[model samples]
Target: MMKKNYITAFDGLRAVGVLAVIAYHLYPQTVQGGYLGVVLFFVLSGYLITDLLSREYRKNQTIDLKGFYLRRFKRLMPLLVTVFLVTSLYLTAFQPNMLNQMRMSFVSALLSFYNWWQIAKGGSYFANLMAEAPFKHVYSLAIEAQFYMIWPVILLLAFKLIKRRSLLIFSLLLISILSGLEMALLYQPGQDPTRVYYGTDTRLFSLLIGASAALAFPSQDQRLAKLVRARQKGLNRLFLLAMLLMLASLIYLSGQSDVIYRGGMFSFSLLSALLIVLSTQANLYLTRFLSNPLFRYLGERSYGLYLWQMPVFTLFELKFPGATGSWLVLLELILLLGLTEIFYRLVEKPARSVKWQSFKEKGRVFFATPATIGKAVGISSFYTLAFIGIFAMIGIFQAPDLSYAQETIAAQLSQNQTKEKLGQASMSQETIETLSQQYEVSSQVFVQEEPIAIVGDSMIAMTYDHLRQAFPTAYIDGIIGRSGEHGVPMLEETLAQIPDAKKVVISLGINTDGPVILNRNTIDQMMSVLADKEVYWMTINLSQSQYTWTDQVNAELQAASQTYDNFHLIDWYQATIGQESAYLAEDMTHPNQAGQVLYTKMILEALAQ
Candidate 1:
């Protein structure tokens, strides 16, 4: 008895919402309010599912509990399992450090418990690593599933107890009020609101709003339908205006503030409900635009696209670190869409169709599909228990690998000593002044003989210690300091300290956010200062790990390298990208000791010519 027309515009809206979220993840600055897409999705889900359930109740006068759950499992589990298995295989092949986290996340995602797991782990959905995880999108699915489990039972019980329409409305009103209050209190300042975002209590109102809208069915009067039809165009315009306003507000507010409140949540939920109502009512222009075939296609495959895009994005970034810029970012976006489309067609779509159809026929709703569910559950449980047992065994029964432990301790101690030495040797005011004077005098005396005077940012400083070791007898002075201090001003400071210095070596480009625009004006000024001196500019090293912005950085650096003659591009990135274990530190930012050594050797080899 569910009206097919009611579901028409929902798919198109969903397509737009999913696209928005994907674009935001791939190119955040361009689609700053993309996160709101998830909230919109939640609203749409509540409205549609509630309507479906209500229709069933009206038709049969009793809910088919098994069918309700079976349908959900069919709709969701196929794609979920496909994504989980693909990601697991990818990790097992290429990434081992991720094994533990991936397994836990996969288990949580499979069980529709990721939201709670995220809360328990205090995980940030927006953090760099979190964004890369394949299972992160499952959080919203988890929230929706939790509602599905509880709402039907409550409605069934309430229907049995109360025949009065007013009582049903009153009960829904009470639930909404309580949910709103809980959201507000949980979101108050200084309160740990992790549960509010993850819990059933604070999120139930969104579902209730949908149910309320469904209960208010369209009147049968022809005059009322005509009135609604006549006003549809105006309401459609209003919905469009509201969407634009909401998007702009999110972008502006994201740039200005960090605080999130339940009022904000309520406002967003209201806007979503309005949009859903307008779309479902077939408000002329909105429905037409949202229901376009292209959007519908994207909508049909949206879940698959969402599942596949993040891990692929991470892989792309890894393959082309330091290559992020406007154009490269655009390319990444296109590639994501193309790749996701292929995945949907070839893998996810086929798998889901097969599994879902089978499950529908069987009328069984296991955690996953019954064919693979037992194997999945068994494997997942075994791994979980095995990991725990292994960890405990290591802690309790097994002795340490003495040689390996000793070597690690020794290496750490050596690093500590070196850091202490560097700390003590850092120049005081008087020493810096004396060195400055000496550098000035020596620049004049040894201008022709001094092979190199390194200058730039932390990248230069990081290589300095090793470079000194490489050329102990050569006069190679480095005038580099901390990260984030590289610019024209810092260059001027270095030149001031060494007035007669020649043969400047520039090593910069890390920590830069946008396109690496090497100021031609600054290079021109330096050329004027060191008239005939040979200038060797090393290209920025590839990042130890990939980031969303890495492609932009690489593209800019490559462009800049092509522009300057004296700027010799070393292409160190070719060897380093995706080799995170070979270079990255615990923070995943700076290079570790082994990385420092490896990079220094590469630079020396590059300069040997």
Candidate 2:
């Protein structure tokens, strides 16, 4: 807790974690695997907390459970409470609907069980098309808090009975191995891995790895610390290797990587533990580089940065329209750092500096007077109004997700149809026949010899009704969550059913597993199915927050369109580029009514041409 005891290089690691997480949230395309930063933090926490607990047990032969808990509360709660209160107030005042949706998550966060709560709600961390939750990052905090409470007790029991550092280290190693094995065993392919990712049982290995490191190199024991640092050359080389691997993990690892849930986490944690050990004793250039002022400053305020980041980015999305490009993301980082600095100074610093004896001490103050109370009330009111004003302006300027709007329209249409059907049934037979003739005359149903075949993913499913209205006899096979790989097979089945069809529209590529690239072979096979017919290919308009390979998929589609005479490209990417949030659902990938209309119109216009 003291300045002398502080490991400066570890602060640098903290900076890495914060930067990775923030970058991933604000600009996911840049850091596809940055969520691993949370794993880094977990390992670091396990090391530090275990060191402290071990030190306490050695000195007094008993752990101060009360003091430890109080310290944790002081260090963590103030900023968390402030952020929660501010976010809740803003949501309630401006986005009241979000408040209802977030209530369960909010409660879970407050209770420090957000990970389990999200799992219970069937949340998928890697689902590209799911809407963002405001408190999604709190899952990591829940895991850390759970470890903070439980690990010390485990350490106390181990130290009391085993009475040997080597045995404690061995025991932690065994538990870590078992934890990793459990994660691998629990993992199921083709299912949401969020249950595995969020589960404490599966994630405990990272923390235990760090704990094992603490036992191997006790930071507080001066003699042991000196002994570890004695072989400075060997320690430095190990530190360098760990740094390289850590950077490699950050640069390359992704949630989509099969290894991440299957022993990949354990591998990363071991690297992190090595970094911690090297941080304490290596004294290498990497250590010095990590201990620089800028890195240390960012690291020191990492907690505040982590807590405020998602809310700030979500606010940016709510306030601004379209995709968040590099410039906007840079601006967000600056704002995030600025706000985090302010939070650290005003809230975190004060919380850490003040040592309260009891809960009652919170009621007592340095200046207890009517003037002080009035000042407090005035400040509170100002903050409330400021948050409300900020959110209200965002609401007014930025358009809301049109998915809800589409739902409302659908519900109204269904009700009207029900009423009209009832009225028609009650009418006389002659009158009903006359009305039916009028309806048939107005309705647009193509009576061509060869109907167009439409094939694609969920985007096609969204425009199915509109497509039906436009091309009534078209053979539309739009499967939800279908990928480009499945398109050829679906096309085969649809063409078999509608063999006379002379034209087809393929709208594939929105829901590919990882980085979406147009498979040339698949397209060629589909072309063979429609040898003499014209084929229209629709480019993918992906959400920047959701998919990383939208541009790649679009580029490939455009290139393919130019390569072949029969293959025509419909520029869905260009058509819906800036109007993403407006036309698409909250996920910013799937189409709503506006998007459906836009897509349908484009197809109709192309057919006329």
Candidate 3:
């Protein structure tokens, strides 16, 4: 293949893609739509690869399959393997719980089918569980790799069979459309779209759009070249507009938005294709900006940046929980850049320089030194010792007591259940004692005098008296094994019965069975009914056994507070994050007396607010 001049603008685009992904990973709320950066990368790969293959075909009259694969390996694998080794060693040393998963994920990533692997494991790309999959981001890389594997054969065949640019363009367009339609048809609202999101069939449109552009505007096509040159000024303006549109989409589109999977993704592909088309021309303001030194440098290191961001963020967040702010984010970026520079210098550059015929000689020259051998052996020994140390710590700190802890947690749960049942029995016993101890006036119009209505499940029941004590004029409606859905209707009924009472405290969601979406639905339903009332919703804390749903439910509750003016979160989740284990009764889910007290305090604080 003829050596092509490097375009600095492409590096700028690369920087855009990588930064978006990093932003999305670290601060998802701020850049919810940054996943579209993956689409941009896909498009860029298709465009550049197609351009490369076209040049190769024009030069040699055929594609060199072995050479192409080798080139791709050199381009992608060195950094990938380095990251995998480092990540695996780190995980084994620090988070043994992740070892089994890392093994599967690492192998899947190595084979370039991680996206499908995740689908097979029933993992959702956009779900919170993605945090568990260390190599989840590699799914996009896998997709591009899959494209690279098959696109050449398909393109070669198309060129051999059709031999016309028009036919090739038509075929690419058809394929892209079919892929888009497949994605649209496969997507279902209110369900995990992992299959659709991760499947190559659903994601092929972006690549094909780029491919079609390459076919449509072949470098050697004089007629098209003349036409493009004639309209260069207008085309530059159009490209500038296209660039703005891409930026706008990145800013405005969110992963939660329905339009993303259905049609917006395809729209993004078109915009990316237009940007590529603009990149081929010079003298454009957008191109000049993209060709700037900063963009070019970042773009050059973008691959390493993308490869390292997830693991780095994951480890950093785990090591420094709750560490945030501008300075920390800047520090993260600097670390990412520094690591990428090292990888680029030591791994990527050398790998790129390797020649297949002289591979053994190059290897010999690189690895013959005593220092290299010593370094490798030393690093291996360090990792082995670290692994041993980590396991020793685990055994000393956790392994021997693991069974006892489970038993204790189980016993605690059983005790809470028994207490709950006894409390229910006591409710009737206390009523009987009151009836027998004091004479009731038959003529007294049975009126509930409480102004505050508190409703919840067993957790709320456990703390019912505490809540009543805190707000003496409070009506408590708590049931054992109840969920948020069951409580909303009762809340509405309570509001109806106590029309004079405008303030209500809801402490449901500890036993919610589904994901955040389901919990959010419960909140939305409750808000629709009690939109006029001052509702203070208590966030939940579940034992480690139900921690996943616990966190998600609290997140939904917090998000709801932002959306609804009348809905205020009591923030029991934050209050109990590190303290819940101490406050948990026998039942891992229910709060003990101390937890109940804290819960009451949180509610009172919310009321004060």
Q: Indicate the worst ten consecutive residues by lDDT in candidate 1.
A: 416-425
Clashing residue pairs, backbone N/CA/C < 3 A, model 2? none
The lDDT of each candidate is 0.56, 0.69, 0.68
Q: Which lDDT tens digits does candidate 2 get at residues 261-330?
A: 8988889999888887767753466778888899989899999999998777766655553344678777
Please, what is the TM-score per model?
0.59, 0.68, 0.67
Instruction: Using TM-score, give the best candidate's number.
Output: 2
- Model 3, CA-based lDDT: 0.68
What residue runs in model 3 are displaced by over 4 Å at the alpha carbon? Answer: 1-5, 130-133, 219-225, 362-609
Candidate 1 or 2, higher TM-score?
A: 2
Clashing pairs in 1: 322-554, 323-550, 323-551, 323-552, 323-554, 324-550, 324-551, 324-552, 325-552
Q: What TM-score does candidate 2 get on C-alpha atoms?
A: 0.68
